[model samples]
Target: MAISLSAARLAVKSPLIAQPDPSHTVWSRLEPLATSDDVSDSLQARIADPLWMLARQWQFNELQGEDAGSPISAALAVVGLPVSTLLHQQNAVDAVTLPAGAAAIEALVEHEQVLSVHPKLNAQAGQQLMRRLRAAGLPDAGQVLRAQFPAALPAPDDAVADNAGFVWHMLLDQRAIDAQALASTLKALPDRAALEAFTSGLGVAAAQVGSAADLLSHWLGWLDELALDGSAPGASPYWQPQRLEYSFALGAQGDGPPVRLQADEYADGRLDWHSFTLGAAANLPGGPSEAFDVPPKDAPPPRPPLPTTARYPGMPADRYWEFEDGRVNFGMLGAAKSDLTRLAVLEYALVFSNDWFTLPLTLPTNALYRVSQFDVRDNFGITLTIPPAGWNMFEMSLQPGAPVARLDNALYLCPALNTLEGPPLEHVLLVRDEMANLVWGIEKRVQGASGEAIDRKFESTRLSTNQTLRPSADAPANGALLQYTLQTPVAANWVPFLPVRKEGATPANWAIQLQRGVVTHYYQVTASRLADPVNLRYSAFIERLRSNRFVETTGVQGAVDNQLQGFMFHPRGSLLRLDPNAPVASDFLRVEEEEVPRDGIELKRRFNYARDAQGRALLWIGRSKTTGRGEGASGLKFDVVTRGKV
Candidate 1:
């Protein structure tokens, strides 16, 4: 059922103050409009200049949005948009003076514009802003923001205007950019190979960023430094010979690998040969590996409908199972699709393989079970990868003048496309959070079939014996449901909230948790009675104990150099004090004694063992105190006690 979680909703507290968010895109989207034309024409008129107008318009139309005039109005509206406020914040400077501190605020405002050009300025200005902010008594605001993010940027000094647009458009960051100018610089270079060669050996250097926002921010700063404005944009400003070129590749193990690149001799803003990697180098012989086809995509006969009694579930609740109660309806996707103005790429991920246990397919606590995504063309891409038995799917529409949230986020959008009249083309799209618009989409030969991609399910984890759960055939429509009950017996090893600790080599003389009740909880679904297997978990916590905080805090003898100062200690190699909070073995002890305990007790002949007046045991017993349910569980006496006098 659709329950509105009160915790997720945002309540507007102020217009000027920033709101907390999981996604920081709203801030960057609204920034241009925040102090520009539509919302604050006064501010726009105040900073009005040919260069500013040209740059802003180019950015609006090319880099990110269709901001009828400005993105402000939409960014501040609270109704449908995620924004919590609309009114602007008070100006920083309020008044201006000659000192660098006085101009710092204004400088920040201008820096915001050209920040994409010079990233180093951001840190510099940040320092200046910190000083001025302290002077202004706004240290609280000076603290790093939780929702702060990168901005967009145009390409660096390159000479291919169209390519510049492509570069900025496909950015993974959101910062200011002047791609037209950078692209122009690259275009002026002789050819592509030369262009690639010039950038081959190059890597992001000091004061520069690789993300879109950093790129653009630094670009703007460079403009200020060079006394150039991109209102007059260009393509191919740099040119070079073909010998120097480069490409990017994932390393040998398919993880992050160093890039292979080169650069040309030609150097100048006009044109330079810079060889560079453009996109993922498909290790496949000719191109990217073609995605394997499945049978469900074609018009295959549908399987018998699952019984109406079947329940659909998510983590703890069965969403579809409560359909009669109007909790969740699969119809929401189609309804949402009808309402959306434009459609961005939708993604689906079905975890086919996972690492959970020595045994396979029982379900793993460490693995994720849900796979889904949705984008408002610009907002977020909609995708879903639920259990293999998912009940519904969401579709999207592409349109003209779509009122989509100008989502061109930190994506690498390339050769933007529009909806077509026929069946969608066969393509495999690879998108990453880092590269939005520039997805590695492989236009493929449409395979006429599709199939269930999810092979494994997330298994239930029993943290406590008091909790019980079960799996249902008719539950959790989209995801799986895990239901729990109270009073479930827990595993001896299970304990909630505490990090598991293992015993160290020199065992601390401690008591043993020999037994409990007859029944116990399991590491995996003790709640699900079926298919229980042998060795579902390790034997009853028969493990040596690690040093616990209690011992660390209370141990008084283990101290050395101020460590373990607060507690008592049982030293092995030396007389050491124990500090509970410090990670053990990470640092040395605060203080230590020259002589250490050299011998330990042999419990076999001892019942109440200890050193006597002469430091020797006078009497001893073999049996330990055992009573009640634990006694029966361990096959020992229950209720009664055994005593003997010497």
Candidate 2:
């Protein structure tokens, strides 16, 4: 066993260095070139490596792509995800390496977000809650003493108090009280001086403290009046508990009449409305241990809209490196007023060059599908094109889905929607700077290699930074967007591109289709929650992972480990293979193709992006029993099924 294990250990390294593709004899050359014998020895070493076994079993083949050694590219290729996800995927992993102090700062920010957004803090609800809490803290302990053991009670009757101590059991025709609720209500109200003419305090409440027997008697009487709550302490019989939720009193008053004390320390405890402890604990939520230090009651909290709703700029129709926001933001199109009915779908590019001034893409004929190399000091960006057209590139869209893009990764929108075809125009690249240090650094990295040189040609052109910030406002044309910055360049002779969208302007579409209408197909869509749910998958709880991994993913680890986790080792995802018709949208932007079939005619539609109240795009999926409507004799009725995931 020891000898066999030794051989296996050495074999493990072989596949890592193997010619993953068996057909490539040149790539498989393992022996030294100086002698045939040495060559044979190298080949033997290759055969001994364990990895070589896997390479052979899987027939690993290397294809043209981002470096195989790169974490992003390797992960993307494995799951058939998009390259745009690389930056984010990698960053998500790398961020965890931040110093502990920085991590703590991030945690603090997260806590602030929670505090600001938690729903319980609202004025409409918080005030009432606080009042109830205050009520629990109010009633003095002397009241219970007077009601149950009068010797401890205050008053002019010292003899009565002394006599009551001997007889701990008290008799009483007692009325009920919700000490916490009543005390809170009393404290919350404006000064008694502020109230209208109705002026009378609960005399019974003020009088109950006279003696211990009286206090105990009244407390017991109040307890008797409470209805039985058969639920687990803090639980309501009808309502499921919210996380960390508590109901101090339940079913304590919901039945036909009054009852008395049934106490257990472990049972969800209840406080007397007039109990000294209950009144004293009023005015706080979570009682004491869970109490939060809240801001003044009158102030309102501020909020930012979700990224999907914020005004964001859509991507250029070609491979380009125009700036987009450094942080999360939805896109805004800088639309211009013009009638483009006569024009076809056109893809415009805006490529960024390290040396060249800003250049715009010219739509020579078709979508300028490209793989342009743009620099971000020490970064890269590009768009991949699939051949023969009408093919899906993203194997997954959510987790392990399209690009498996990390939250802040770069994006490349390609296969843009267009009716015409041909290579796109190259964007005019530029180089300029703000601080002198960056300009000098770029100049230093400019050493000519691969015959690819960073050369600049400057002009005496005056450019306005706000050139694309605001566009003309009009119907349809209002779609023009604002340009965002990804990384602020010190200075650059940046290329200038037309940022406005015309009626016939082509767009980098989200989903694509070919040959319109209903057809059998296999597809996978992703579902994600827009907001964090306080339950399930949360790290704060342990019962989380025991759930069906088939349904939920615990809060994801940093992006690197996330990507490294790759889809292959992941718990199985939902799989569905059904032949369904391609969907149609109501916000008609472009029609790619249309076809009539035996069962129905499929329409490939691009909507203008009008959304419903819930922010959903309404897609119209039309169906027909008949086929072939030529020359518009009679059209078919519209069948609409909205397209969006919850």
Candidate 3:
């Protein structure tokens, strides 16, 4: 216990030595030199020392890069030519100067009334005309007109006769009314001078108004002269019921030769540059009209290039701390092996998002352009000339076995059309019938005379009632008796297409064409002879033939005649002509056998309208094709008998 009393001091020392924190030294404050005198600039998080930044870049392996210099300035010399002429039906004989807008072409091809006048609008126009006549000092003008020319006024409830043409027909037709009686009844007109003034205002010859027909004609003409929202029917000369295809030529102002382009399938209201193909090109003095010259008067003066930045949806942010849009979450995408599209999208978003650069160039619409010279100056003061080559994006590809070569280095800015579409007015199902050894064009829906969509099935059902004969009373009393049918009748909407040998093909060739076929209906006749009391003979049924006998069986005709006589598809040309003729004399429609697959296809036509950049509204009818519900059974059979519960 006394060991604690010894005061023995012992110090334990090791080789390790401790030193003060170097950051606490006053000299350390001056270690990081501020190159900028401004306090805000010095406070920035960015490293001021270039060497340190370069070292960090090297650590990130950014130094081992494409070695290409960043572009500082670029000069692109382009030339554009406006479309000057249009050719219809692919015929040079039908060529004419191009219209001011593509809507005219659409309206003409689709048979859409460019100046569509509704019944209400027609009535409004008539009321406005009457109001103007009254304002011009005609006392009780509306009442007097109604009383004197009762036939000219359409009944308020007569929707069918509410059109402008109907009013003209009733008023201006000599057969519709007695000219002398109408003239005598029109004595309510104050004097001949007043009548002449009215005729002059209507842009009609005053001397032609001697008869009632002429006066009514003048009145109808005056009604049309009023300001209306739409153009008159047949106003566009480009419209042709038989010809839907159109082509055009783009040319500079007396510079280079014109380039001809064509659109064979403009049935779809959407008119874009992709709709056309290079039809022809003329050779220039140098070599060919490879590029056109922009009209000097129309071209803008040379100016500095406006800088453009590239961006895309669902792109990752450049900085780690930056916020990103949550609407499109690439991480949430669950891609499977079969989801190649998703994989490609992910690759584009994550890997190649920043690989694109944008070059801004303003070009006129409805024109063809070509880059004559494109030179880019990089940060290293190196100028690189990029010549027109085959590596063009969104370039029109040469159609398979096309007669014309690809038009290289061409850019077409077709008339910009952004359309809004209504529900399909017509729907046709093109299906293959393996059992019948034929393909069918089923008219699911067809446009009626009043422009309403009618269900073809319902119409066929309604018309086909009591068409087929019932079993005769002469049938045998045996319960097991059989009844024979020459051929089962198919629905009128199911058109038949027979496969025929392709034209000009060798015997070894496997090509065939699907030609329109006819379906004939035959009636059965039973005959009984006294020689055989228990047995009876039935005559072979004869086909009831109509006058001219050769009918084009496009099933839709049975529901509504001449409904399908318009734009259809063919192999040689994208569009086929369906001629309107009598059922007995109609021409057969032929299509390539390969166009119809085993699964089938669907075609639809819908009403569409669009507003152009200049705020002009264009209306048209467009067509679309989609995958159909597989093979269909038409229930057609030959020489079949049923022994059922009857």
Candidate 4:
């Protein structure tokens, strides 16, 4: 059994080592090496470490007074450990190496023995020790109390006779206070004067002059304002603007009692109102009524003289007039000479820049489309034609289903009307010409309260999204617009290119067709991975191998034993095939081999294929390397052969 086992072990040769591929190198299993060390020593010595107790007693005695016993004597009474144990374990506290060791030292100092053995030590001494421990990066016990109070409050242990000061600090900083202490403090203040004197005596700001009730009310009002303006503790700064939103039930309030209009005195006097329903229409009659006499076209009315009649003091009667030349005449008793004054006409031109300093009006085209109830009948035609000298890249105009009207040079209006009359109709204007690319921001140029022609200028060069544009006066051009920007729609997320009528549950599959410089591009992409199967294969063949054999039966220590005389064993041809069920559409191209470093050869092949019947082309890569390994046998008895494994 022993000889057979030996022969079997000898026959089990190590697998032949193949030359590695130069095109790729194996990577380390760990991206970064980790470090580890045992912390047993510090943890084991924690119970007997007397340095912590000694330090605690030393600090306690210092706070107590001079002439206190030595630190060792206090430590002996506190820890009661033997001198050898103390000396041996002192290093654990003196040189803390682990977080657990620090924790153990803290436990030793804060142990219950301190109060029993040295009951006279004030908490202040222990607090100072705690501060020292905190500085040393050790766990502390005062964190909970400190966190509850304002960070600006001096630690109570450090300050002398600061109870009242700490109380005031807590109240001012919105920190919690003991209810009993607070009540007593308030009760002691008989009046605001006394309270103020007490506060001043404590070096704190004076309380307002009033009774407790009045003082409380003032403080509460101030707190409320502070909260509203976001100035309270930990609140966002007051400079950040707060958004106020108001929603009214239009149908419910339309016919209700009229609301009184109140305006702030400091307001800019500019107000905007929007309505969701269609606006009121003029009640013009289609045909003439017979309530009055009608005159022939181009004919003068008959002239009638005024009738002089004497009427009773308390009664009045209606009388018909007799027409002679078909004219009625009336005269006033007094007439003054009227003079006509000739005024100079101020000729001012409004110029919008196409390239020069232009207005920041990027038409609020987005808002126009967002209107839920725009009267389609109110749609008007707007044409923006650059003068012959300007470049007309393209034209942008409102389309059907989106009502837009051009009022003047700077205002294009899209009114979202609410027939029931809740808010004023929202007017979304495309304030600039798209072809000109001149952005114009809304500016209100008002001259007091008089109704006058508005002269607005572009305030900015770029349009900000969701910005409210308020024009001072009516626009004067045929193409006035509020600037807007269009964002790229994410594929499979939004179908912005398609005409949206009703919002759907999920985004519809849509394509965008864009005409660019020479080619028109069509794009449609979905966020899904291809699920087609693919095939891969790798093959190599051993060309030759050499073998050696020895006849010695006695095994030599640390020496290789050979058998079957001298022989060359080589296996040829090997293949690894993977048929991944993927759609193959094209033949492989650019198949070639390159000589790599260390006499290595790499084969690379690329092919175009389709994953499905959609005919979309995809590229695949095939790469492999071939090389020789191991040294040839040196003895002549060793022979070389091929095509078999030994």
Candidate 4 residue 348 C-alpha distance from true site, Å: 7.4
Give candidate 4 misplaced runs (Cα > 4 Å): 1-210, 226-271, 274-646
Off by over 4 Å in 2: 1-58, 61-177, 192-646
Is 1 or 3 the stronger prediction by TM-score?
3
Runs in model 1 lying further than 4 Å from the true structure: 1-114, 117-249, 254-327, 330-646
- Of 1 and 2, the candidate ranking higher by TM-score: 2
Best by TM-score: 3
Cα lDDT tens digits for candidate 1, 516-559: 01222222322233232332231121111112211123232332
Cα lDDT of model 3 by residue, 1-646, tens digit? 5333125453335333233345542221122343433333322337658888776566544555557787777887766666665555334565556554444344334443311322333334445445555554443444455444433323221223223334444543321222223334445567666665554444333454344334355655554333222233421233322222232333323264445565655534556667765544222112124334334324341774643547876577654325788667665665665667976886677556776677765555556666667787887989899777686466654444433356567666665556677776677777998898788878776544233455767544432312433344575655666878667777655667788887898978867887766555432222222123332221111111111122222232322311221112111111222442223234566767766778887776666676655666655554565667899988789999987555
lDDT score of residue 184 within candidate 2: 36
- Give TM per candidate: 0.13, 0.14, 0.57, 0.14
Question: What global local distance difference test value does model 2 have?
Answer: 0.21
lDDT of each: 0.23, 0.21, 0.50, 0.20
User: Model 4, range 461-486, lDDT digits (tens) per residue?
Assistant: 11111122222244353342342323
Worst-scoring 10-residue span by lDDT in model 4: 74-83
The all-Cα superposition gives candidate 4 an RMSD in Å to the true structure of: 51.0
Q: Which prediction has more favorable lDDT, 1 or 3?
A: 3
